[model samples]
Target: MRPKDEGACSGDGMAGRIITVAQQKGGSGKTTLTANLAIALRRKGFTVAVLDTDPQGSLGRWFMERLQGVGEDGGLEFSTSSAWGASYEGEKLKRRFDVVLIDTPPKIESDLRPALRVADLVLVPVASSQVDLWATEGVLDLAAREKRPVMIVLNRTRPNTRLGAEVAAGAAALGVDVARAQLAHRVSYAESLGRGGAVAEGPAGPGRDEITALADEIMAQAGIEGAATIR
Candidate 1:
């Protein structure tokens, strides 16, 4: 992918695209996606910043571990904010980064609007389960009200399984755009995050490929041009 021009704006006068990863269901891989996607974007030659709006502070903890392990942030900036402060903090980071990703807490309600309102795109991760699919409604409804574009990502899927097929079909019925790229059940994702790094930093494998594809698709959905081709 070509590097973004320094003066390129998000077309709304913002210097960067703010992508809020939200899901009402807990354990939907919100922080995992945020951390891995941040690393993926950085590798694609885009400066990225991650904003952790969840009170749980999981994303913030991961960044701290990454700092300790690597002794540096690897050009990826990180910060924390309250649910209400997401807009302010995210916008502030946008000025200096190519992408700003907000990792929101579980449970969708009025509190999620502040973050959704400021997003160029809202990414909803739905794990391969009927329960996970059901939990996505509140998030989809909220994003619809905010008029933000949303993409459903199938996460932790078990390929070639009946349950996986069922969940994929169920997600399609929600009338939202489901990403063609899906993240499978992989120990690499969890193990890497435990070390404050991403699967992309490890040897080339399916885990890295899944993240790269999803990142490219997300950039396309956000109307950003020149996403890196899958390696």
Candidate 2:
């Protein structure tokens, strides 16, 4: 039997662009990246929704905390689903929001395909270590198979370090698009996430700037247009 048609949005018109943040290894900061990116986009006046497909439920937990602490999500919507259920839930979300960010679980191989199929752009977060770089291969290959556009995001990077430079070069050598905006290793990223808030909520700093630049790059790559002025 043929595979069921998993609807994929072309990111045209008003359909929300679905961005799946996938990595084969854990601790690559996928959840952190998703949460922060959602906030950045929301600040740009895009209605955002985050679909957490990771079994760990980190994103869901953060959203709950945000609700408790802030009494509102600040225009961000949150949902949870199994990895396989991402396509269905993601498509539904795309209709109602300007951007849908899917956070996938670690080490999910074949199960990652459904999410990839629905993604207009797949963001693979590679930390500043060779181990993290090595772990990204599986995800890169899978996204390639699905013919999804991918951008490698260098997360938790340390500045002025040889290892950081090497990893950036190595990522470029992979022949995939690497994001120019790299997220530095920042304590604020974790502290804000723990509070169900993002760096965007904090005072202007490197963390906020990094996420904003990356979010802008992602919007361009996803072909999303007409972003409102950043508040």
Candidate 3:
């Protein structure tokens, strides 16, 4: 059986939400987004953990760097997993963290399916084009099969561009919940990880605000408003 959707914060009446970040196309900034989102939520005074299912090991390496004092300390919990082991590890993480962020590989495979099956919400990051939007169909199909909620994030969006808005509208037309906040194409996003930390650990910038705002919107969607917190 598929896992049901969990709460956004403490009051939603569940242990925590399992968010799987997936994009079939590589270099969708999945790892960067995941690390930054995990840190942003941690700053909100919530206990957060990450399940790195990507074989690239980018998330795992980032966490190792974080422990070495390369970035601001998140006190974030982390675990690595095989594609086949994702479901088991995800359940364990839900019991321990307020939120568990799963960074899936760039392809839809047996490993990716289990993670999708267990997610409360699956975040699909797209750029400002139909190509990006098209890339998400496979993931959307998987989420649909599992009857999971989905949120589309427009990453690397150019300011004052009609393309971003158009893409979002097209997505909404197709029944995807597009995020109100978007990530800008900023150097801070990529360079922060070079220092072995998330954008939240860097100097205050739009990158930081965007991620925080996205986190807030996501929690609200999960009905986690008010004094809610995950253990």
Over 29-139, each residue of candidate 1 has an lDDT whose tens digit, in order, gives 999999999988877777788999999988988999988997774357888889989999998888777788999988558779989999999999999988899889989
Residue 87, candidate 2: Cα error in Å is 0.7
TM per candidate comes to 0.92, 0.92, 0.86
Better of 1 and 3 by lDDT: 1
Model 3 regions more than 4 Å off: 1-14, 70-74, 225-231
Q: Candidate 1 has what TM-score?
A: 0.92
Instruction: Give a tens-digit lDDT track for model 3, residues 1-231.
Output: 112233232443456678889888887888988988887777666667899998899998888877786543334678999877888899987875677899999875565788888888889988778788788888888889889899988888877878877877777776889898999888888777766677765676788788889988887766544333332
Clashes of 1: 0
Candidate 1: give its CA RMSD in angstroms.
Answer: 3.0
TM-score of 3: 0.86
Least accurate 10 contiguous residues by lDDT in model 3? 1-10
10 residues in a row with least lDDT, candidate 2: 1-10
Error of 3 at 204 (Å): 2.9
Model 3: residue 146 alpha-carbon error in angstroms: 0.2
lDDT of 2 by residue, 15-64 (tens): 67899999989999999999999888877777788999998999999999
